[model samples]
Target: MSPCSSVPEAAESVSRFTERPALQSSKTLRAAGVWTGAQQTRLNVRHFEFTADEPHKVGGRDQGPTPMEYLAGAVNSCITVVIDQLAARQQLTLEDLQTYTLASQDTRGLAGTADVQPYAHAYRLQIAITTPERDEHTLRQFAARAEHICPAINLLRDANTGLKVVWSFTEQPTAEAAERLSNAAVGYTEEHDAPKPFLTVTNADLAASVSA
Candidate 1:
């Protein structure tokens, strides 16, 4: 006698249990490798430099991240790091991860021109995330969580900005030694130093025969 109930309507529950398959547990859930580096104090780029300090003059011209641009870029970079960390932890294999961001704003004479909002500028990001396994439900759940927890997603949500992502999958090769295993796969012949024929070759006998 099971401790479970046996009401007249309890037959439905028993039937469901009978129809349900037995629970199957994985024998071993491997521990994926660790991924590090989450801080971004600065960026290394030859074309530009961005710092939190006051604007610095570059090439006799003052330049640096504009307040709004910095906000947008921060969201972009944060989202990337967040996704990377989450995916790595989830043991999701990735082929390529890319984000394209666009922001729109309306200029109204620099802040003082009439009481107006900044056109409610929006930030649109298209993220291409590839996975090794095909699990639409799991992927969708991951994406939902990723969007909710990602810094960029949080920022956009807080700011009432529009945000969306286009998901895609592509095969990604493992990061292994890139050295050629064998040149024999495609052999090459060494060049030999040889005299070149500077003049065209014409058979004299053939020329005479034609003349005849």
Candidate 2:
């Protein structure tokens, strides 16, 4: 299906959120995981079930993507979805959107051989889009807004992970253009500022009222 096929629905959802602020509320997400065997985990979230495992080099069957790979995928998917929704809300004609994500990690931390961080140190996303707006500044601002609202991107940024995003825009999305984009050198790159960590607060008054 065309990427813009859901724009109408996205626009309607955005309108609902704008029209009714009360409809926006905190939602809890739940997921469960079970360790099957040999560095493999069976995961369940909502009605979806998937497996995560390590490769032969890590001593497990390469049944599925590793947790780190999943993390990268989550970031990419979140950004894409956010951008799509934003485009819909802005009434922008979005013909195509694609993203490639890369992460750098030090496995020594996972092996407990070094005193280093176990998670990804940095993440890079290459974003290609076909849109009617040709102004570079406008496109960058639009993407920045989407990045600001993207949850996964914020999660990594709050954790002090370095992020680099490169954007490429085209008037037409052709197979040749896509191939060039995949192998081309860097274009416009954006490095966002580090986000401030949120502070958790305890509602003593609410607790007292509940107890009473």
Candidate 3:
């Protein structure tokens, strides 16, 4: 539950956001990555950096995760979050959730054999979740609806990528499991603590000082 729930008008306003364009603001999101050779690349996010690489089997040095792995995880992560948020608004109690996403890409395009070697020739998402307050039918309906809310889903579908979603519910197990799920259920209940900045800059100092 969100802190806004305490104020009916505030909660309603939050819900009203759903009817508006998600990216209605003129603000833009950005990230930059640099290739480090041998299928290795370094990604830079605000004050953060991580390496990405492919396995030796695919002519890489196996320094880190492959791009496909990152894509699969990104899709799953985004949708799982969508499910959590959507269910919360519906007043459903989710106990446990896990998702597995699979996608296949054709290297033919990379090799110049085809114009498109879509990241996923075929895709499958298997979601196993537990929402104790809602029946299977209701949960399924919400799950499908949440899929449509996912930005990742929109990207994949728009690219004409083949995708499938399969989900099932199971009783949540263990106290730790319940606690973990509870944490996820609790949405942002507080205002932003970080000094919010809206800008694009070449360095951290300038970014922190300016609002664009």
Best by TM-score: 2
State the lDDT of candidate 2 residue by residue for 136-207, as single tens digits.
Answer: 556656766676577786577656567666566766665534334434433323222111111111222222
Show the lowest summed lDDT stretch of 10 residues, model 3. 194-203
For model 1, the superposed segments whose C-alpha errors exceed 4 Å read: 1-49, 52-62, 171-212
Kindly report which residue stretches of model 3 are placed more than 4 angstroms away from their true locations once superposed. Answer: 1-23, 134-137, 172-212
How do all models score by TM-score?
A: 0.49, 0.72, 0.66
Q: Which residue pairs in candidate 2 have backbone atoms (N, alpha carbon, C) closer than 3 angstroms, thus clashing?
A: none
Quantify how close model 1 is to the true structure by its C-alpha RMSD in Å.
24.8
* lDDT tens digits by residue: candidate 3, 84-105: 8987798778767776665668
Q: Model 1, clash count?
A: 0
Q: Which segments of model 2 are wrong by more than 4 Å?
A: 1-24, 174-212
Arrange candidates by lDDT, descending. Answer: 2, 3, 1
Clashing pairs in 3: none
Over the stretch 1-212, how does candidate 1's per-residue lDDT look in tens digits?
A: 32333323423323212233222421222222221222222343455544432234322122345546667677667877887888889987766565545566655724557665563455555455545667655666566556655745644655645443433333443221011111111232221221111111122222333454
Residue 193 in model 3: shift from native, Å?
46
